[model samples]
Target: METWGFEASNVAVAQVRIEQQLVEAATRAGLTNLRVTTDSEVETIGPTQWLGAEVQANLLWTPTFAFLDALAAWPEGFRVTGFQYEMQPLTPLQQEAGMTAPTGSVRIGVAFPVILPPTAAAPAAAGAGS
Candidate 1:
């Protein structure tokens, strides 16, 4: 069994919505059997929220091929700032046993830069301004 890993970053404000859409898109693109695991952290940068996340999905097909197809079919409104793929080889014992590994497993994670949004800056008093 081949495993595929996907990492998406710099998402939009509607992170959850977009994530769901992406999953649907993947399913429509012939990746039906999908298992999803997700984690997220929020951060604030000035007014805008800078959020980052990593999503890993194991495909039933070849890892590289599935990843490429998924990447190509990714919907708009979501920018994939970064991505990576790794091939995890099966153990010798498992190979000897002639057992096929499970496929279509997905893991999603998010890492935000700032947890809390910054409050409004305090105004300076007249004396302080002087």
Candidate 2:
């Protein structure tokens, strides 16, 4: 991650799984599966933790979650593996939709690689003697 210069945070090991979603028309026509998936797993990682301050790299972005979710089920150190952001007005979009909610080109999402603290299972584990 350092080599790429993209900041890495809350480092942990993550497992990623992929699934395909087939739209109704495609299913009926036996066509290819749609790229869109309803699976929520794409939005989150689990069973993760935050690294100690000693190991922190002073990253620009840190893990964050809703207040309630943080109290109940937030990972120890949630960090985004992928993200998108933009700045735009919310009122016009709301007026167009006849509803009030945040909207814009900007968006942020977390997918997979919810890093966990290194364990002793690996051959070159952290803190292992050289």
Candidate 3:
């Protein structure tokens, strides 16, 4: 096997796409007051180029089964590295608003391979000088 490890250049775009998809999934699952943030990075795994990011989101309540199902069906190249959730105590505002359910925070780590277009090797780089 050969190593095609390379730097990923489309990190920003990938992060935005991930955030959008997460938001959409939350909406579809009826998760309200959704707030999200993402931190993006790149990594090389053998012959693959990957973008790694952590998506942190705060919701009014815990995630539902529908959201988990949607995540399971995420598109190819989208890999779940980690997932965690924390239940937060209700704030004064929430209590005042008659909300009984505690707020929840979720963190999802993901890594997706970057599919790059193939390029023709230069003559000099292809052993022409040898």
Candidate 4:
């Protein structure tokens, strides 16, 4: 089985809405067997101001490679901003038992920064009724 983690950023208004969208997108892409867990409030550490409320999802599936490929092929607007994984080697005996030991499971962590159009920017004030 394959497992992964995902994250999204720069969200406006309700965060749950964005999470639903992502889950829908994944389901539409044939990732039917999905288990998602979310945490709305989170904390960070270290000198960098690298922390914010985050929603994390863990995906599990069979035929790991195919699942990863499908995720990579997500639409342009739905960019997969970040990813990570852990590697574990299997013993020879395990391989012989018809168990396809995972070379590694990729943890996909994405940061979707909602970029509004320039026109959406704040309007400048008229200087002294020019």
RMSD of each: 11.5, 14.7, 8.0, 12.2
Q: Which stretches of model 1 miss by more than 4 angstroms?
A: 1-13, 29-53, 59-78, 99-130
Q: Which number leads on lDDT?
A: 3
Q: Estimate each model's TM-score.
A: 0.39, 0.22, 0.57, 0.39
The most accurate candidate by TM-score is 3
Over 67-123, each residue of candidate 3 has an lDDT whose tens digit, in order, gives: 667767765446778888899898999999999988777766766565433332222
lDDT score at residue 71, model 1, on the 0-100 scale: 50
Candidates 1 and 3: which is better by TM-score?
Answer: 3
Q: Rate the local accuracy (lDDT) of all candidates.
A: 0.43, 0.27, 0.60, 0.39
Q: Candidate 1, TM-score vs. the true structure?
A: 0.39
- Which window of ten consecutive residues has the lowest lDDT sum in model 2? 51-60
Writing each residue's lDDT as its tens digit, candidate 1 over 71-126 gives 56543312344444344667788788885774334443433332222321112112
lDDT of 4 by residue, 78-99 (tens): 3343556565666788788876
Query: Per lDDT, what order, best first?
Result: 3, 1, 4, 2
TM-score of model 3 (CA atoms):
0.57
Residues 60-96, candidate 2: write the lDDT tens digits.
Answer: 1222122113323323323443334343456775779
lDDT of 1 at 103: 33
Clashing pairs in 4: 82-109
Give the range where candidate 1 is weakest over 10 consecutive residues by summed lDDT. 116-125
Choose 2 or 3, whichever is better by TM-score: 3
Show the colliding residue pairs in model 3: none
